[model samples]
Target: MDSCEEGKGIRTLSTVCEAAETAGIHMVPNNPVQVLRFSEAINGNVRLLELNPEVEKSLKQGDRVVIRGLASDEAILCTESKSFEVKVVETSNTMLLCRDIQTPGKEAFTASQSAGGGLIRQEVCGSACSYLELRPCRGHLSRLAEVLSEHQYAGPETEPDNFVAGYTFRDLLDLVQGSEDELWTGLKRCKACCIDGFWRLLSADYFEQAFDRIVQSLAEKDWPIYEVPVDECCELLTDLLPRVIIEHCLTCYGKKNDNGATYCLDEELVSQFYAGYLLRRVAKFNYAEFMEVWQQTVPLGITVALEMLKGIALHDLTARPPVVWHFPANSLPYDVSPRFNALFQERTKWTLSDLRPYIEDLATPQQPLEAILLKHTRSTMDVTGQKLYNSRHPL
Candidate 1:
């Protein structure tokens, strides 16, 4: 039985070792103990859970811990701020769970009041041949595209239809396979908002329009990209779009300035967003023509580079006149095996740089990026060029 906490903010407890260290401590005789396999003993009902120091601390401090997923789906254990994949690992040896077993080293301090005059009978409640282990994992969020895509925020005119879903934040949390922290970040990436009472994804065309308005407004006033007046932009677009949406676009593409009144646009993120918009609308684009248009798409004074498109789009330079196609990281599955297969299916052989961004999220602290690549990919290299990886097995 667990000890009960007394009333008020503080309570008292003691250890057997503390009592043993005290002066004039009386030594009691050890009780005769017997391990009995009770009639209710259920094999595999008990399991050992090993938690990391951080998780233990969080548990001791009364932080929330939840397990998410359907019975058919793989389980994800989530703390308040982090998520981990729950894995079942088998052991060769079996361990039993006994009810009312005395502490192994506290026999000498036990009272002579055993159940039957120092005769202690412990009944086995359960046994286990496996344990549960935790591995760090990115939130399983591919499902977000399905849940929020039902109602896209195209415009205020279409707002009526978009609100039909009526799914709130709690609804998303209940079904989405991510911790609270991961869920918020995923929502931001998907450009989703709690408009009215429902969660909805803002359409790409809408994002493009809002972004263009901001850029053109700055360019007309000859204002530098670094010093964006957030209040003025919000006020101007307040009627056309939600203030939250307006602010969200800015936050996605830029960070706040030190003065705290303005923001500094991140040229790379802005360019990437626009480029992704174009790629998503088309199956593929010619390499030369796409580069020329992409360069023009970004804000003035913001440089565009083919190198910056990693993880967003894949260029088939080996094609005649070359070709570029969208291969976004988000569209891929979260699990490692499927992601690797999808990557190789897109390209038979990929240079390390080209493949890293696609599968980087699958790497964990115990299983790092290099370890993952080595395990799943077959690698070969030239004399001085970058190493190339192919599928470890035939697809």
Candidate 2:
């Protein structure tokens, strides 16, 4: 015990003596020593887990934490509002989980002395060689589009009994591996509406028809196409579509103005809607004809460009007549490897901007957009020197 005066193992004799002199510890051990007796049955069942500050705080607050994944998928740990990829990390140093083990405090030493003549009997309950670790990960939302597709809302006339049980908010929370906040965001992003008691996407044909009515109504009343009045649009369209569905469309297609009274249709979203409508109706359209028709299909004065269709459609210049087609990014895989395989099969090459919308969800601050491209794709340039990306591996 005296030898440990200048060593690292225990609180030094000097420290204890100093503490005694200053009355810092009420019961200063006359002899700062403890005898540890390991149990015959050494246990190794204990688990060592690590938590970040945010996770620790969430745990302290008694928030819900869950591990979610399919059998084929890598598991993720989700807190009430965030998610992290769960990993098993091996450690080099030996770590023991010893029960009844305490610092050589006077109370502990006294307890030991009273029990068995200064013998501090302790037991090693576990030894750790690995620990559970967590790294922040994106929420699992890729399947939302597909899962919600099963419950598409065509219209009120086509809708079944509203009371029928289906995948409601809680159901989706279980079915999809996302926190409530993120799942809510994903639902909104997919234009999913709560009908009766379930979540569903609006069917394309019906949505297109509803959009047509909106456009025609806007043209008839000479309402500003850019900043359409919200309440009036909903009032006029309530008979055609449910008011909730009408509001959902308004929220999806546009941003509310400063006063929140009117909603300005976002050009990109509007253009993408019409472009998707055009591309979906046809297997392929001549690149030139598609461009001309795309511009004409959108509401008057709203320009449609090839750039806006990056996420909604694909331009295949290699085919005869150099065609463009409906190859939505949402339909592709979220994982980089399979996503690239699909991309290559659809088209041989892609410019960076064209490929970004499909893969940007996988990018993080540490792994930016270019890093993913660098790892999964081989880059080159055309005759004009515009950079391009193609799959690094052959399918």
Candidate 3:
């Protein structure tokens, strides 16, 4: 017989590997024990042979016994006897490891209840492999009903109100496995069909299947899928905008027109151009001061400068006739104006000579900006011409 003792972190004397030794069970550590059938009644029960000699002599076959020890993966076997049964008493922190059970509608309802709002809830669906969300609105409910209504596995009612019969991760997996193109098509079609968000309603199985397909496709084409979290993905996309714009201009509008003039007629392209121009300007004007500000501001300074340049470019580009404006020539790196010198002297006790070299090092051009710009622009023009010709004639 088995008995349980409950207390606050009480240390109880018990056998360690003695039970396994008595049973003559030989097994490697960390190996899983095969359980043919689990009898709840037999849990926590210890056989008479498993007890120490002193404890066994003090108790009879029907007497209750309690022993405490650390849990392990080793299986208990009987040496003298082939098989015997023991009664259950208690259990401790136990974890079940097995393939997830197949239960349609169960998970969806559980998730819906957990989310507890009109808003959609995102969660890892089947086996926690991919994200699945729940969409709980009339439109989605209607669509779901329409799709499953004709299926043999679908329950009775076919109306939107009756669509509350949720879906299972297994069903979604089978759906994708059978017809992937149709699944993608359905997902796109259903995007606006649900108020709660269509993807949110997708079963975990479907999410995993679709995600895997996407990854395989990208990999085959030598593309990488960013394995970032959703929020991080959004952040990266935002950071990429400026760089994307720059690349687009270099590819599409970097060439000289028939009049031997390069023009940025596109509003977005012009904005990007001005942003680069401003950064260059700031660096040139007060090199040391700008560097200090840049160090302090870090990423915000870049974002702010880009936004300001974009605004200026937009205002200028919308004028009656677009005009090409030349950026002002930058002052010599070491040449401090009287205004700046007086201001610095007032703010700090440093002399102009003392600060001049540091400022020059920060902003001094190894080669003129015009020369560098000309080289880059010329290379872009050549590439654009080739691209244009290729587009016109595929061969």
Candidate 4:
């Protein structure tokens, strides 16, 4: 009966491994374990190791260990076994060896405090292979929030009173009661820690205050902010402003990629030119002449960059004489050139006159005033070089 029970335990452990593999779970390097390189050759019963205080403390005389990268046939051993032993040869150095055989070159050793039962099978050979299966759930989150609120203010004197989420971490450590080095590992293993931290930082009150603070700061700023009408600003401010504020804060704090709120609110709140200027200013918040040398090329750069991205570019020095899409004859990117050249070659919709049918299809209201003005003053050269008074601007 005892033999049968032992066989069942082995089968159960094998089933666990199979299930873990089926679930697409695998382990990467974990921090609690130290990876040490063999510093010297093993002679007799010992070999010297490179200095590592953490490794020395975690390992014990009777701990089970697995060494990989030594040879294909490397086997598991216990520290107290006749074959294996661990020794501290120096203050910062450790040694591992087996009797009668000298292991060649640097080898990887993993030792765990856990021994007996099915632990060796799970932790097999100190590779630290373990499944990451914890997932956030509603029950855990509610409990985590309650726990965090209770211990939100408990922090060391060195921690600032106003530090965000300060007390919550202490609460987590207390719950786990792990050593300082093990605290992070413990927290990572528990989904509650993540849930609590996320909730604490992203509470409704926190979001409200952050938004208000950002708006107030932006409102009071002295720099040219590319003003838009109040109603238009309000429409976009609620949804888009918070992200801009975060980007600005990241910049102010030197956290990087901080060009926040550089664009006008997207409903044509400000002209593209003014928006670009604001972007340049925010990118160089302190320097008045930032991008000075490159500034001269901005208009051309904008045109070229836009052309490359959209397969065409447009610019208007004056709205009175709109300069719409213009490319050299038959010149454009491969994917775009065919369609663009065909439009001109086919001549079905090349001129503004040909575009009238499409404009009419849009069901636009007839502009009597603009029609009168174009009829009275507008003039253009026709295909035969004869000037005509009825031609309107192509926009």
From the highest TM-score down, the ranking of the candidates is 2, 1, 4, 3
Candidate 4 lDDT, 1-395, residue by residue in tens: 53575576544434544565899966333212222333354233323344233334336443433221123322212221112222323333222332322122222222332221132221112211121121111111112334444433221332366555534454543342223333343233221223324322233233334433443444555322333223333444555444433432222222221244242222121122222333333322212232232234222222222222121122333444432333222122112223333433423222343323212221213334334334423555778776443323332
On a 0 to 100 scale, what is the lDDT of residue 303 in model 1? 80
| Candidate 4: segments with Cα more than 4 A from true spot | 1-101, 104-203, 222-395
Among these predictions, the greatest TM-score belongs to 2
Off by over 4 Å in 2: 1-35, 39-43, 70-73, 92-94, 99-123, 162-165, 316-320
Q: lDDT value for candidate 2?
A: 0.77
* TM-score for predicted model 2 compared with the true structure: 0.80
Q: What's the C-alpha lDDT at position 92 in model 3?
A: 50
Could you estimate the TM-score for every candidate? 0.78, 0.80, 0.13, 0.19
lDDT of 1 by residue, 1-395 (tens): 11443244222223332444586565454444343545453656676888977678779999988888767769988887788898999989987777566665455215533432233445677888889998878778777778888777776767555346646887887787788888887777666777767778777788788777777778877777788888887776677766777677778788889899888888888888878977988899999999899888877887889987998999988799799999888778766788888888888998988988888767767789989988899988866767889999777
As for candidate 1, its clashing pairs are: none
* Candidate 2 local lDDT, 1-395, one digit each (tens): 75763475545545555665798666433443333444577676667779998789989999988877677877778888888888989889877777656565657766655564332335576788888998887788777887888777788787556446358887787777777777887787667878777888778888888877887788888888667887898888777777777667777888778988887888888888888888888888899998898888877888877789788887767678798889887677755677889989887888888888888777866678888888889999999999999888978
lDDT of each: 0.77, 0.77, 0.29, 0.31
- Which has the better TM-score: candidate 1, or candidate 3? 1
Candidate achieving higher lDDT, 2 or 3: 2
Residue 251, candidate 3: Cα error in Å is 34
